[model samples]
Target: MQIRTNALVSSVKNFLIEVGGIIDFTVLVFKQFFKKPREHKEMIKQAYYAGNKTFPLIAITGFIMGLVLTLQSRPVLVEFGAESLLPGMISVSIIREIGPVITALLCAGKIGSGYGAEIGSMRVTEQIDAMEVSGINPVSYIVASRIMATTIMVPILVLLADAIAIYGSYVAVNMYSDVNFQLFYNQAYNTLSFKDLIPATFKTIIFGFMIGLIGSYKGYYSKRGTEAVGAAANSAVVTSSLAIFVIDLVVVQVTELF
Candidate 1:
């Protein structure tokens, strides 16, 4: 019993230390943002890579998500004789919650892992150390660029995903019932408000920041070895994915109070 209690205490201590380290690292990266010689070129390059690489996957997933959701929901709504609410229902769900969260998770897997592996390899190879020797700020050039890129690109990706998902929902709606394009469009559009759109988009930006931060942190602090690179990549994906769900839950609970 004493051993078990000590083990649990050790685990909690380690967890707290990790959290504190991340907080310090985050503050350091944020400070770099205001420093001179801003990495606009690197940031733009990272942003372009982020969007270009992730767009295809996001499109496919968004379409399938909407399609499956509508197909599953149609029967239940039909039984209740509320099939007319299908378009509005899909739009609200896809826009306000599902789309942003799914897109963020997808990015947490793809972009987050990519950043971790790339930076971890650099760390292992002493590239980061070489940069420091050359008087280049690794935090500014590497970490800041990535976090900013994700912060800007994620909301845009969420918007695109929301649009594509709505269209997919339309296709599913017409699978069994006749939903005209104009009528479906109107219903979906009318149901959405600034309240839903603004908060969802804002949440995605936070998601993007967390994904980038966690990925970069894992990579930057990884042990100096080849195996550490892989470990960093894996942990980045897991951490970012978990963070997305936690942030979503907190945001939802807070939004409900308003």
Candidate 2:
């Protein structure tokens, strides 16, 4: 009983420590973000890296996912003579669930890992300390800019992914049956309510923020040595992906409440 009690206490203490670290990190990031003169140049460059360079990855996956989803769903949907509902069903699935979740998971793997490795290497190499000695705020220059880029770019990627995915669905549907572009979208658009669009988009924004925050935090505080660099990247991706799943569950619950 005493050992079990001690273990429980240790778990609680660790949880509190983690919560405190996140809070402190958030405070520092806000301080950087609201500094008198913003670092527009770095932020822009990060945005390009986060959004533009990541576009092809997002697009290819989205297109394939849409094609697969439609094809897989066809037999089930057609069995009940519900073929006409294909566009609407696919749209709802893509916009409400698949698009946001898949895009976020992909970003968490790709972008999160990259940020973690880049900053973790800087930390391990003492470049971060050198920047501070040279009078540049490393956290602001590194963390703030990356976070800003992610917060802006992930949503745009989600939007693009949704469109591409729907187009892929259109192609799939047309291959199996005679469906015109206008008619396919007419059914699709009619089924998508503001509820689906707003919640999904909002959650992706939160996912983006968490992805950036987790990556930068892990990287900036990485342990010494090269192995720590890999550890940071791995932890960043794993932790960000878990956070995305958790946030998604909470969002789904809250949105259902509405």
Candidate 3:
């Protein structure tokens, strides 16, 4: 009984610590964001690296996601003889759930890990200290830029992913059925209301913020030596992925209630 009680207490304590870390990291990023804008050039570079360079990977992943989803859903839909609903169903699922979730996960793997490693390395190498000694606010320059870049870029990438996914769905539809481009899109857009689009889009911003926050927090506070960099990167991805699901559950529940 005592052992079980201790395990429960430990679990609760760890949960609280993680929650506190998330809140503190969010506050710090926002504070730095409004404090003063610094490192515009570096921010832009990071944006390109995080956004533009990631386009191909995002596109391919989205394409495969759509293709696989459509192919897999076909038999189920056909069983109901509701094959015509494929476009609408795929669009709704992609836009409302799969697209944002998948895109965020991918971004967490790419941008989150990158931010963790970059900042972890900087911290380890004393580069962050050098910037401070030079009168540069590392928080504003490093943390703020990464936060902004992720917040902005994830949505754009999601939008693009949705588009590509639709195209992939089109191909998948044509595989065993007949669906013209116009007719497919018409069915898709018809079933998708503003309610679905708005909530899904907004939730992605939260996803972006979480990814950036966790990544930056882990990287910024990393200790040890070179090994810590890898650990930071790994932890950032794991924590941010978990955060994504937690936030997604909350957003979905709230959206449903409203």
TM-score per prediction, in order, is 0.98, 0.95, 0.94
What lDDT does candidate 3 reach at residue 179?
A: 74
Query: Which stretches in model 2 have alpha-carbon errors above 4 Å?
Result: 1-12
* Decreasing TM-score order of the candidates: 1, 2, 3
- Error at 114, model 3, angstroms: 1.0
Tens digit per residue, CA lDDT, model 1, 1-258: 999999999999998998999999999988988887799999999999888789999999999989999999899999999988888999999989999999999999999999999999999999999999999999999999999999999889989999999999999998887878999999988988888988898899999999999999999999988999999999999999999999999998888888
Look at candidate 1 and give me any clashing residue pairs: none
- Candidate 2 residue 4 C-alpha distance from true site, Å: 8.1
Off by over 4 Å in 3: 1-15
Every candidate's lDDT: 0.93, 0.93, 0.91
Model 2, position 201, has a per-residue lDDT of: 94
Of 1 and 2, which scores higher on TM-score?
A: 1
> Residue by residue across 103-164, what tens digits does model 3's lDDT show?
99999999999889989999999999999999988888898888888888898899899999
